[model samples]
Target: MNAIQLKQMTSAKGFIAALDQSGGSTPKALKQYGVNEDAWTTEEEMFQLVHQMRTRVIKAPAFKGDRIIASILFENTMNRKIDDKYTADYLWEEKQVVPILKIDKGLADLENGVQVMKPMPELDDLLKQAQKRHIFGTKMRSVIKEANEEGIKKIVDQQFEIAKRIIAYDLVPIIEPEVDIHAPEKTKCEELLKKYIKEDLKALGKDQKVMFKLTIPNIDNFYADLMGDTHVVRVVALSGGYSQDEACEKLTHNHGMIASFSRALLQDLSSSQSDADFNKMLKDSIEKIYQASIK
Candidate 1:
């Protein structure tokens, strides 16, 4: 198979499986799988447990991306071997999804809300490593809860700030500005997001491009502005706090956006299951998400 660039990853077909949990939700997921978090006093202690979960989670029954997931965004720490091969290599070898890397250092608080990718001094080195390993793209996140113009501005500004750097390194940036689904201004905030993102991307060089990882808006097709933008290769939706059923319903309503979900994608999966059970759960989730993505 040939290498996949950022544009091709989006423009070609299918949704993105946002499995780059970054260990942020690992404890909760592990607990759901019947793992005891009380014994592991430190995150590092749970490394093997997380990797075990990842291995099981990634054994997605092989399928074409035609009506399924186009790619996967793997956690930065998941570069190690699975079944005597790198997990990314296994995914690529099986022709399941384009493998990607998550390079952000995680979120930090702004005066108003949340901003992602704090103190990412080593991101350049990481991208070079991903390139060497043939990872397709990267995903970073910033979140907004309500309509604070200054906070929204900060979110977009910071996103483009890192996006330009990622492009320079020849990686597609999945720019995520996640608005809380329950926010009072869900509709209003989405309108503001379109405005800010459009303004921000217009300032970039003509050759520049980005994929958006957005929150599902209250109304369907609420992101026509972004989906229509030439600079936007694709728009992918995040589950935020929605259940799988609700998320799938909302995702189908949006014309251009596809699912790039984390929790929603893994909710039904558990580490305690046998290999057959785990794979069955994956197939079920993939089927549901695939149906939604093509809708």
Candidate 2:
């Protein structure tokens, strides 16, 4: 399987353009964003641009691609702060593609917090309303048994519609669903996976290719089970709180394809003293990982 890791710092739109130009190379862009030469660009700027591009593509009638995996921070407040207004604007306009709201990781400290789910009442209500207006719900995990069926159905319907659009444009849109099972109970994780696989099969049928952004632990044991399965599975391990090298080693040892060091990498790139150092690190890391996976 070919492995690709989308760094959060690379704007989705820019990345897509880069892919079009370099056939998936990370360091080059044929069309530039036309910014001042000396201006320091932050990861946040890239994220905002990507979000804007995604919104445009979603609304466009013609767009083509086989599969695209978007790696984003769901519940991290630091990630949310930059795009809050953009989300609010979409909500005001009644657009269905609202950002997935996540519970602040710190909320786990509160009493009885285990029962506290994210997607606060306001966002939850908005999602419910959006389902009525659009074919798909914004939340990806609605397929799970614990999620509201009505909502899940809407999301599935919307996904089917999007797939149709992809086909119409001669593109294949593989919905890459991701979930953070970091703190959940083992049983809960298993249940979620079962539902995910079932729904995915229903969506893709038997012989179609499907992509997923998964954490290491959730799919570790099931790796072999998926080995000759009809669909192509690409697992991206979260390297936020763990050792990136260790995670990559384990995934590669288990026959997994790609591993991402996004969080740690972004931090280093953002704080690096020199632009040359940052660029070199980004280029070298991507090449090293690509070579390792291929070998």
Candidate 3:
């Protein structure tokens, strides 16, 4: 997992050529080599490779360059439970690159890992509103209602708090809101989001600037809505079941911060042969993604 090992196994020349002529043929190339067709898992593997290579690069005293931002996307407590140990282990083992943990949990769960949990910033504000009966509680309807304007504002606040605490640990806290654009509750949520935006601008303090972000799914048109915002909100399209190039193209076109791929990619890697070919495939995909992301 060193830079030399990665470069040698990936074959930089072949990788570059693959990417260049990949012209949309990358999927075919990958399938021909028995690479997983699911973009999400494929992208995840690529990220893991970049992380390993980047770690090696940073350890070299002679190496000096911009740092890479590595992130993991987790949905639901199940995903969190599964990924948290892996992420924690990677963070502990890796060096240099920033670790961004994106989760779809309540503010409390988001804040649980770090210190300075008291005076819960965003959750506190949310609870204040919820206490007034101005928002929803933990019930299904309430949860849905609260995830909107009033609730989102509070979540945004909580994100700020988490970001502050994460920075103290020298890591990055990524707040990933799993917004369903096509849900029946979209109108209420949208209204709340508008109000939340105004409130966010006012509550956003010096330390909280650009530290929080919002992630929406299954919507391509909403990108325009977020374009004019002052706060940093990243729109990520779910590409788990799609083609990698299509996912990459959409992410590129929309200027997305991250693209989530299929979880199956990990399963594939786990079953992959431990021989040199497996290593080469892993290395090549990693470098390809790194180059794509940087561009």
Q: Could you give candidate 2's per-residue lDDT for residues 1-295 as a string of tens digits?
A: 1112212211122111011111121121112322232332664454444443333332232211111122222222112222344332332233322222221122112222122222333543433333333211121221222233343344345444443433333222333222333544534544445454556456664534443334455444454454345554333334424454555455565454444444333323333235455456554544444433333
Query: Ten consecutive residues with minimal summed lDDT in candidate 1?
Result: 1-10
Error of 2 at 173 (Å): 3.4
**What's the TM-score of every candidate structure?**
0.90, 0.42, 0.43
* TM-score ranking, high to low: 1, 3, 2
State residue 10's C-alpha deviation in candidate 3, in Å. 27
RMSD of each: 2.4, 13.1, 14.2
Candidate 1 yields a Cα-based lDDT of 0.75
What is candidate 3's CA lDDT for residue 104? 23
Q: Which of the two candidates, 1 or 2, achieves a greater TM-score against the reference?
A: 1
Q: Whose TM-score is greatest here? A: 1
lDDT of 1 by residue, 41-65 (tens): 8877776677777666665553445
